[model samples]
Target: MPDRIRVLHVDDDPAVVEAATSALEQEHCGITVETATNVADGIERLDSEAFDCVVAGYDLPEQTGVEFLDAVRKRSPDLPFILFTSEGNEAAASDAISAGVTDYLRVDGGAEPYARLAHTVVDAVERTVDDIKHVQNTRRERAIEELHSTARAFMRATTEDAVAQITVDTARAILNMPANGVHFADGDSLYPVAWTARVEELLGTPPAFEAGESLAWQAFETGEARVHDDITSIPGRYNPETDIRSEIILPLGDHGVLLIGSCETGAFDDTDVTLARTLSVHATAALNRLDRDRQLREEREFIDQALDTLDDLFYVIDTDGSLRRWNERIPEVTGYSDEEIDEMSVSEFFPGDEHETIGAAIAETQTSGRVTVEAEILTADGERVPYEFAGTRLTDADGTTAGTVGIGRDISQRRAYERQLERKNERLDEFTSIVSHDLRNPLAVAEGNLELARTECDSDALDKVSRAHERMRALIDDLLTFARAGETATDIESVTLADIVEDCWQTVEGPRATLVVEDDRQIRADTAKLRRLLSNLVRNSVEHGSADAQTPSGHTAEHDGESITVRVGIVEDADRHGFYVADDGPGIPEDDREQVFEEGYSTGENGTGFGLKIVQRLAEVHGWTITATESEAGGARFEVTGLEPA
Candidate 1:
């Protein structure tokens, strides 16, 4: 039931061809015959027409059938060739068969020879075509197997460098290329990885893509593979030599592109296009996953940095009241390690009733999805640490409470500062009240006495009363100055003791108090305080000493020379300066020397009990020490030392 098998007959002899065609044409009952007379003419017929089988004479006057079979094999190797000959010469038939001839037919025999040759040609053609198809199927299966294996290997790669290297190796193996490389685009720079032996020679530093010319842009615009058959002539392509012929670009992912190059033009065919598309789909998906993972890693690092930077104790707790997370500052605040905190409960941290309160609040926050206000906590050392804690529920995507999130700020120092401020304010109020009530009474009595004596007393009595009033007023002023000293501050400065002594000398009242300025007598002090201190010293010297007094032995009289004996002398004492107020008068007794500086303690009948006290207060304020002893002049000597040079 098969269709007719057409046969082309070629021979130099027409008799041999007719004999064979007549006998063989009817054998299959579905065979047809076409004849050519010579090898050249037979090849011409084959070129102009189609035939499944060819029958030719072994010997031809122009060319032998063996030669004709060789010619046919050059153009179509799988086409069937059969020789039909009248020559019974076995040698020529054997020669034709040896020269790649399929079969031979002898005209002396019946139609059997022709029928056997026609059936033989039909079987040969079918088997050759089947072999070609099988080879192609095997090649395709091997290519697919390699692609799947390469994809698996690529997926296991961890870093970007590893991914690029795997891509290049896989591309080279699958594409059968001599060289391959992967280039990553960063800004306008191209970074190459996994370079092969001939990579530099084939592809030098490629020119940067123009703003509008990129593999990503071209693929998006066309939604197809971007193939460059001529790298040297393509607009955005770079070719270092004429040998660099082909390139194929595939999108790797949102952020990158994959490029492949071949030395032979048209190497990337339809199969390559399909394979590349498949690879790109998987590569893009894998790359997207990697990008998401990198972003999440960076975000976590940022959060950790922020938490570590904080000074306060930050912690999180689970619904079971277990500490889950904390910062490094936790050990400084709670005296507990991360491992210890992990085992502790809410009650273990806050003691007594506060423990219950905090626990309830934490539970409430976990249940209600709200923030719990600050509550006091007890440390591991049993110290009542003042803390402000706020907790909120942590929920999952399902909006369920996961745990209690809290931030604990230690407010103990702030609370202590507030308490100190309150105490200071209370002390200031009491001090103001006392200054108004207790001190003003004594001042009022002294004022009334002076006013009464001014209108009711005579000359001698008035003079004595006026002197007393002046002393009382001076005492009041000194008291006010001492009170104000405690309330204010003075500017610290370098001062000259000689300048202070000169200023005090001009202000002394009773007698001549001279100033002695040495060449190097500069001192460091609060200038204003030093001035007040020296003025009081000079006044006391004048008030208590005599410029001209008879010696105890009365052996020496007053000096006849017209010079004041009362003089200020400056001298050095170790690292300090000593200013001595000396006079040729009676010396003070050793016992009363220390008692003179006590407030309201006086020896003179007209003394206000505040003169020496004022001097002592000023000396103490200026950080100086004053000593009273016998002077070189055999008189009262008040030496103020501890004077630092400016």
Candidate 2:
């Protein structure tokens, strides 16, 4: 409602038009009347200018007041129209009423009638404006509610494409803009991703905007909303020949831009911009959520792949023993489907007797942060397979114990090997008893007979017989030592290298060999096994190292050297740390280094070949490795690596 009310007064007489104008303007301060001499002139004025109400006389040059009212109804149906005529007949009043006039007034010859007409016009126009306002207010309230609904839909949208489609649809239905589209930013350009069907019908297909190509990119880069009342007047338009007269471009953060267009100029107002901005905010939030979800999904997929690649079963269990997540290996090894495993508890995979042990282990893990246990897994096919499971407790963000993450490895092959080793050890014990008791008794009787024969006849043949007996005794002792070499070490302790080397040197009968302790380091090992390993290596170096040396059976041989130096020192490298024993004697050839460790492989005639083999076996029992190489003094070197520091 404005301060001034404009009315169009149409009449056939000039005097009546002038009198009507003066009366209407003088009656109401807010009223202004413009006069037209005929119906055609009044209709022309109504089309060309804005007027609040139309006042026409019953008689005109080309048409009557009813005819003029019909013409006005075709253009502005809600505009207030009044028929003021001098002919106050029943027929004229009926026609005017039928023609949909706002009010029918008779032009009585008085200034009061004009005054009455002016008041009627003013009342009609005010009612029309009030009705229009009411409708607009109702529509605005409904639009706001619909926008709220759109926000909920955005929350449910899991993909960017879905958000784009909803944005375009919302602009068309709620904002009342049919020609709309959504453009997403891809690299250095904006591509149209979604649009309404009406948009296609109007402009076929919208063009994509490259960098600096259109106003859409400008708004997207600047994160601003732009409203173009008449796009035709704008320079550097994406489509200069396009039919769209008005456009609104809104930026959706860094994700993209939303475009709304119309064929009529100045179609969108301030309210449209405000509503569009709300929609843009919702769409941007949804897109950002979708982006984060995609990244998390990819990372989870990568972790799953890594877990599946493992040979053992990997799982995540809750505090209540329910399986929360598992790798593919679990299903493959247990012969259970993923769905079945999901419903199964952690204790259900083990036997009834083992359930208590597993529960204890899990409780310990929760307390100590880690636990390991070995139990037989009862598979779906009813087969009991031994498995060793290790678990570490998991915690939530608040540092509360959530559950356990762990791996279970099949130990069936290990169990089989252990059973085989037990059988071998039993047979070895039986053989050891035979060699110590049964063989030694007969050998002692032979030695007594040989001593008696030596007293009777002192001859060269008797010397040969004594040497043969000594060789037999040495072979039997070596056989017994080799048989028991595979036994695992039980007690582990720290021992200094220099002290062990000195003790072993005294035990070995190496009178012409000098022991050199270069660098000493403390190592963790079984004390008895480490002593045995060092004693065997020192004996081998003294007996066979020199060119001329006696065999273990007391047979003398020729040699060129009188003394050999044996060095014991630490060996440290980037990948390994341990100690080495080297002898300045005839170094083993590279071709025979690997064969020297084999049982019954020796270079000297009278040397017991089981010494080096026993050294290797003892090193392996301690989870260490030994290698034979050339020493710095052109001699044999034995390195024991992978030791645990004291």
Candidate 3:
């Protein structure tokens, strides 16, 4: 990311070091040179600071150049190491090659050697950056893909039981845990509505437990998640299932409890705990929406009188534009009582010739049954404020206009919002063009160079170049996705996990990776966006899960992540439904877990840090929610919820 290049030149001859350092910096646009007299000082500089490349002489006072290379390799392996020495023979070249030097340059009479070394240093640093980026992008893509698949399953759940079923399936497919129970709460007890073999026998009756009695009851009463590692060790009158050694009870607010149990003790960990909490929260929201819709249906008879509680101005006018009736809200805003408004013509609220416009609006309402206008209205204080008035004409049985009912709202805030949105759209348009053109073009060029570099040399430097290229590409991609996520989704339909996952995985580059499909649930989503989302998630898993797979090109650095296995499936708990993606690799650490989705935060050297941000944005586009935790194989697990049945 830094435009300036910094290289450390170390040698025993002061004159040669000064000449080369000065010549390299003078010739390059953004190169700065620093020097050390011996290898010890160079090693100290590396320890205390950072440099793009290390240029050292083949012969040093204390040791050979190979020894220095070996020592520096221990500290930083991926850093470019170049040998600038007097030895020009094949034996020396072979020794440098065996020592894993990034580049070799023999001392020549002129400035050509230094100039060539400078270019090599730049290319080597660029390659390292690419390698880091490649890994980051790969993992992000996988994580996003899993999130999308889970989202599809969540949206298809309509009923409470369906929600729980999806959650169970998600557990089996993604979490690789098959035992769970979805429960509903009665007045003083909990009843099993949906469940799997994990906790079936414990709650088979109409009511599973009395209020505040069992783990499920306790979760409901406290409105919190409960984890019992060893059920036999707990001294209480509980489910008393001998086969079940561990259980997790997550509260679904007032709805019920989601219970996932295991026959083996200590089968669950922190990731499961966090997952339970997240799914429970989602279940609560789904239940709330359903309850609200049900209540609205039952209370429709009193909707007419509810207008009085609204803040807008409400009034009735005759065909002549005379004010006949108005609500208390009108008086509060206009500084007029009901009696005064009743005595005044609706035209009186408009100053001067505007009354004619009101009269025409009233007449139009009488003819068409409804009319709306944005016009200025004068309050009692004589202040003209912008207002939007919508009116409907009341007609008799004979079809004669008797009066007009109208509502007026102040447009001041609406106007401000409109302007703000307009400006935001303009900025977004400008940004989209820049991302589509500026960064993308250069990225393509870099990618081409990376391929060239790979064919020219067989070293880990190519990995760095590839990673840096991916990081830039991911950033450009995130810009487009971010804008789309905030917009309304017009093309929505049921998307199947089995279908979407295959399509998404095909679009991303997965190295030494396998995708396992556990359940195929249908949920509502924009097909294209869902594919994009899943692609990013899967990429994330593939790259991050294999954190140890990378080998820093020149140094002795070792990474264990080269291949990974990702699982996608549906998850259910008592009264809640969702889906998940799990991997078999090094899981995310607990300390860095909360900030994973944050903008521009990354642990990977080449990461653009926008990958998860894109994932979260796409989720908002579909009105879904997501969370991250550890997977069953000590890898990351991401769950998505807030779904409705397709």
Candidate 4:
């Protein structure tokens, strides 16, 4: 009912033909009849036109209905052939059926039999069409299943040419075409890249479909597939010694086109068109993969060239602390070539004592994402060089650690500069002590004479002179402490904090001061430097707290032991680890906290600011940070952090 079914009726009798035609016309509106009066005419009709059903009379001129059925079977194997006759016999019926006739109808003498013949022809045509469709549908389903089975193989193909040829072969087998070809677009021309079944010989030349010269161009121009039953009928179609009757052109997106041709006229069916289109999709995917792979290869090459131009030693280490790759700077810095480095691990470039430390640092970076540390790496000549190193963790798409990438910056020159600066400061400290010593002796002599003169008579002028001499002595002693601030602790050993604090308390001239050892933590330090730092802090606290503070006579005032209580305790934070010194007294002003460590920054007339400055200098020598803040009782507090504890 979806389309018209063409019926061919061949007979030697005009009356019988007229009856059959009239009956079929009245019975079936979807059927159209083409009449032939003889066997020769029937054969001609079958060859030229596509017919759904063929009905023939048994008594034909020169050929019987059975013979004519055999001729139709040879031309169209699956076309419905029917025999309608008046002289019907069992033997002749068997013959007609054996000749591949779909049905046999007896021409009895009534319109009822004629009507039955018409119905039989229609039924025969519908059944044959359904059978042919079922076969085609089965083929299509099989082809689709085969496509999935081979898809992985096609994707894994390493070469573009291999994939292209595989696509052509797959399309040819699925479509049941005798010839096929795969073409790609190369700038201005579309040329065949792979072909099968003498497709090139059939074209008489390598087919070129460019400049809109052939019907194949329509696929590229419209971005769609096209089918032609007779390719030779199109204008500018190629002629050849061999035959190629039907062809289909499928576009590989904007990349290229695929062509498949057959030798039988109108050989391609609707199923062929669908299969060719599906092949086009797979071909396009292969082409895209190839293009992207080429682009990545070029990008990687560029990155390698860029990294080689850098001066710093840039390298990548595996997750296990093994060297994976490095730049040309590696050989320049380590005196090892790329070939030798390939067999070395990153940990091999460090001393044996530091190998475990650095390895752990790299593992920690992988877990924590980044780490920065200073260490030494060894060169080929067994020389150790200090380097400032930083490592970062690299991850793949799934967010797992792929490796560790790091940069090593040599700091030998920086270390040398620091040593030179330290030598200059030590000399300056010596000159300062000599000058203070020279001035202190003259001031002491002047003070002794003034005191002797004061003993003779209580002169207000003499008292003021005596007080000025005492102040000058205090100034000289503060200058001496500031000059010796450059000296660092030479010998580091495990010393108890409480023991050091008790010893330092005896050295300061603060008899009214109270000491509280709140923490008994053990630390690595120089005993002399720790005593000096603690002594200065205690003196500063007592002088600021007592009513009659420590005088310039190197003695604490008698304040009935009512002085500041200084406490030493551990101070720990998210980023700091060390101790704090706090005092219960009138705290330093908030405005002056920032300048507390600067020389000559006095909070009051009795205060010598060099005490806090000495505290800061010794803390820096030990590589600690000192910060001043308020204590819990609204008193002054100095925190020294970033200490290595035992």
The most accurate candidate by lDDT is: 2
TM-score on alpha carbons, each prediction: 0.47, 0.73, 0.41, 0.60
| Alpha-carbon shift of residue 374 in model 2 (angstroms) | 2.7
lDDT of 4: 0.80
Q: Write the per-residue lDDT of candidate 1 for residues 520-605, one digit (tens) a residue.
A: 36666667766777777666656555445333233333444333345666757568775666665565667767877787876555
Q: Quote the positional error of residue 291 for candidate 3 in Å.
A: 36
Model 3: per-residue lDDT, tens digit, 1-646? 3588788888888877887787678767687888887878888998777788888888887877778888888877778888888855678778878878898887783668767766777777788778756754554455345545765566556677776676666655555567776778889988777766544554444347787677677668888777888888876647564577887888887888887878777777665565556556656676766677668876853563676688898787776667766666888888877778878877778888587777788778878889998888888999887889999989889977789988999998988888897888888888888889887888888888878877888888788778767777877777687776666566998878889998888866766888998998887888887787788888888777664532112122233556788999987766556678888867666776768889886666767777787788788777888888888777788887766733
Clashes per model (N, Cα, C within 3 A): 0, 3, 59, 0
- By lDDT, the candidates rank as 2, 4, 3, 1
Q: Candidates sorted by TM-score, descending order?
A: 2, 4, 1, 3
Superior candidate under lDDT, 1 versus 4 = 4
Q: What lDDT does each candidate get?
A: 0.67, 0.86, 0.76, 0.80
Candidate 3: list runs displaced more than 4 Å: 1-309, 316-324, 335-337, 344-411, 440-470, 483-498, 511-527, 546-579, 621-623, 631-634, 643-646
RMSD to native for every prediction? 18.8, 6.7, 51.6, 12.2
Deviation of model 2 at 512, angstroms: 4.5
Candidate 4 residue spans exceeding 4 A from truth: 1-3, 87-95, 108-112, 230-245, 263-265, 318-325, 328-346, 356-371, 379-385, 395-403, 411-646
Model 2 Cα lDDT, one tens digit per residue, 393-440: 999999999999999999989999999989988988999999988998
lDDT for residue 637 in candidate 1, whole number 0-100: 73
Single out the weakest 10-residue window by summed lDDT for candidate 3: 550-559
